[model samples]
Target: MSIELDHTIVPSYDKLASAKLLAELLGVPWSPTALGPFAPVFVNEGLTLDFIQTDEDFPVYHFCFRVSQQTFDDILGRIKRAGISYRSSVRGPVDMRINTDYGGNMIYWNEPDGHQWEMLTVSYARQSA
Candidate 1:
C-alpha cells in the first residue's frame, strides 16, 4: 500500500473569509462545492484545501510551500508591504526556522483563525522539484 496526502480538513470559524484569505495568500482560487458551508481549494491536481467552520479552536498547524528564490522574495515583499510580521530567521532568508524542529526556509504569520501558515524557498516536497 502507498500513502500520500489526498487533502486536508481544517477547522475554521468563517470558512468563506478563510477561503478568501487563503486564496489570496496562496494565489489560488476556491472551487465551488455542493454544500459549501465550506470552500475547497486545490494545492495541485492531487491535494485539496478544505475548510470547515467550527467553534472549538483548532490547533495551529504549520504547512510549507516551495517557491523559486525570486518567487519567495516577491512573496516576502508582499507580506512586508501588507504590514505583516517577518521575524528574523535563525537560518537566514534562504531558510526560516519555525520553532526548531518544524523548520523550513519559510516566512510565517497567523492566519485569520490563528493558523500558522508559511511559504518557503526550498521545497522538501519532491526530490526532483
Candidate 2:
C-alpha cells in the first residue's frame, strides 16, 4: 500500500488575506468557502492547500510541499525574479536556516503568519515496468 497526502490545513489569523497571498505565491486562485471559514488553494495539480481560521492565536508550524525537479527549478526562478531573499543549505541568515534533508533538494521560507514553508524535491527510483 502507498500512502499519499489528501490535503494540508494551515492555521491562519486572517483567512481571506492569507489565502489571497498564498494564492498569489502559489500561482493559484483563492477559493473561499461560501459558508465556512476555510480557504482552499490547489497546488501541484491535485494537492489542495487549506487555510483554516482559528479563534485563538495559532502556533508556528512547518509545512512542506514535495515537487518535481522542474517545478522546483521553476520556483527557484520565480523567487529570483521576485527579488526575494532565498537561502540554501550553505547560505546562512540571522534568524532562518535552509537546508536539504534525506539527500533531497529543499528550500525553506516563511509565510505571513510565521509558519515555515518548505519546497522539496525527492528523486524516487523508477521501478522496472
Best by TM-score: 1
Candidate 1 ranges beyond 4 A from true positions: 32-36, 89-105, 123-129
TM-scores, each model vs. reference? 0.70, 0.69
Q: How do the residues 14-115 of candidate 2 rate in per-residue lDDT, one tens digit apiece?
A: 877777766676566778763466798777555777889887887888766677778777776665575555555423562333455556676766667877
Q: Write the per-residue lDDT of candidate 1 for residues 1-129, one digit (tens) a residue.
A: 578798888788887787777766666668556365568877667777798889886787766667666766766666667666554442345333333233445566767787766676654455352
Q: Residue 41 of model 1: what lDDT?
A: 71
Global lDDT of each model?
Answer: 0.66, 0.68
